[model samples]
Target chain A: DQQVKQNSPSLSVQEGRISILNCDYTNSMFDYFLWYKKYPAEGPTFLISISSIKDKNEDGRFTVFLNKSAKHLSLHIVPSQPGDSAVYFCAASDFINTGTASKLTFGTGTRLQVTL
Target chain B: DAGITQSPRHKVTETGTPVTLRCHQTENHRYMYWYRQDPGHGLRLLPYSYGVKDTDKGEVSDGYSVSRSKTEDFLLTLESATSSQTSVYFCAISDDRELLGDEQFFGPGTRLTVL
Candidate 1:
């Protein structure tokens, strides 16, 4: 069974508009959530993160919103630019459950395209 | 940015052959991990090491083995390759001294194809 899921496989948005990506998790033990962006032939780079204690976290034009009650989270990018186009992955960790290490569970991923 | 490199970035081998991939890191992080990325599976953990000489299996450890003899290196081996095992493999490192947010730095990747 997939613990984390990204329902949408792809998303397209016009440049200068807002882009939204959603993710859902089945395990309630997850306490920390993170987002990573990947370009072709490259490793993923950290974009933003949010703790379960808080409902939202923002950095520049990227904002991450968490709804613990719904076990869902969304990433919002305002004024999306063509450079923002890439694959986005959502990951969650449960430090308490994985006693020794904070092992992560990643969602499939969503491909984002910012059209000109 | 994490000073990590994966060897044999691209390889092709026939079934039943043995293959090993290397991961070297300069960060000297205490934790190293092996993951495989498939089209529909996202990224699945194969094995991980918390320290030199200490390794453990992950969600998808079958048909694979791992070794961590030194602090800066980790190895993943496939005893007998199979077509089903063809995928992009990634290596990641983490430092326990940092926060417990589970942030991991990844290497480029190694694409292996089993014919």
Candidate 2:
């Protein structure tokens, strides 16, 4: 079973517009969520993350909003740029007893294309 | 980005052959992991290591084996190659003090094709 799910396979948006990507989770034990961006033939790079304690977190042009009651989260980018065109993945993880070996469960990923 | 490197960036092998992929890290992080990415499947964890000689299976570990003899190296072996195993594999590492779900730095990934 997929603990995290990104239902949208692809999205297209024009430059200077806001881009929103959504994700859902089924596991309640997950206490932290992360977003990663990937380019073709490259490994996913860390983007932004949010803890369960907070509802929202922002980093520069990227923002992540989480709704615990709904078991959902989203990443928003303002004034999307062509450089933002890539596949985005949402990952979730639960706390570990040792605090060193937390495992991550990832979504199917959403491909975002920014048109000029 | 985390001083991680995956060797044999691209490889094509015939079915039934044994294949091994190597992940090397200079970060000396306590945790290391291997994941496979495929179309529509996202990234699926195959195995992870907490320390040298301490490893565990992830969601998808069938037909695969892993070993960590040193802190800087993690190896994944395919006992017998199958077409179903054709996918891009990634290696990730994070420090011990990092919180759960903290950022995981990944290697460039290795693409493997089994025919």
Candidate 3:
């Protein structure tokens, strides 16, 4: 079963606009969530993350908001740039429930396209 | 890529043949991982090693085996390859010096095709 789900396959947004990627998880045991951005032919890179205890975390232009009750989290990129266009994968880790704290369950991923 | 290099970036092999992929890291991060990426599936863990001679199975470790004889190298072997095993594989490393050691750096990727 897919514990993490990214329902949207792709998203298109204009430059200087906001791009939001959504992810949902079925397991409430997941306490830490992260977002990774991947380009074609390249491996994914860490973007942002948030703990279940906090509702939001921001780093520069990228922000991650978590809602523990809904089992949902979103990555928001404000004033999206062309460089931001890539496949975004949301990953969750059940640090509190598992010994392998580094183990992560990833969603299918959502491709974000920034238009000129 | 965090000093991680996966050799044999692309390979093609016939079914039932054995194939091995290598992941080498210069950083000596202490934690290594293998994952496969497919069209519908984002990325699934295959096997991982915490240190030399210390390894564990992951989510999708059925047809794969891994060995980490040294701190800098992790090898994944697919004995009797199957067409279903053809996919892009990635190797990641993590430094668990802190409690939140969830950040993992990935290698470029290795594309394998089983004919």
Question: What alpha-carbon RMSD in Å does predicted model 2 have with respect to the real structure?
Answer: 1.3
* lDDT for each residue of candidate 1 in A1-116, tens digit (9 for 90 to 100): 99999999999999999999999999999888999998888888889999889999999999999999999999999989999999999999875233356788999999999999
Pairs that clash in candidate 1: none
- TM-score for the B chain of model 2: 0.95
Where is the poorest 10-residue window by lDDT in model 3 chain A? A93-102
Per residue, candidate 2 scores C-alpha lDDT tens digits across A7-56 of 99999999999999999999999988999999998999999999999999
Error of 2 at A33 (Å): 0.3
For residues B1-115, could you state the per-residue lDDT of candidate 1 as single tens digits? 8899999999999999999999999997888999999887888888898889888888899899999999999999999999999999999988762453578899999999999
**Docking quality (DockQ) for each candidate:** 0.59, 0.73, 0.63
Give per-model TM-scores.
0.97, 0.97, 0.96
In terms of DockQ, which candidate is stronger, 2 or 3? 2
Q: Worst lDDT window (10 residues) for model 2 chain A?
A: A94-103
> Per-residue alpha-carbon lDDT of model 2 for B47-113, expressed as tens digits?
8888899888888999999999999999999999999999999999986645534677899999999
Q: Residue B59 CA error for candidate 1 (Å)?
A: 1.2
**What interface RMSD do all candidates show, one decimal each?**
2.1, 1.6, 2.2
Name the runs in model 2 displaced over 4 angstroms.
A96-99, B97-101
- Candidate 2 has a DockQ of 0.73
Q: CAPRI band of model 1?
A: medium
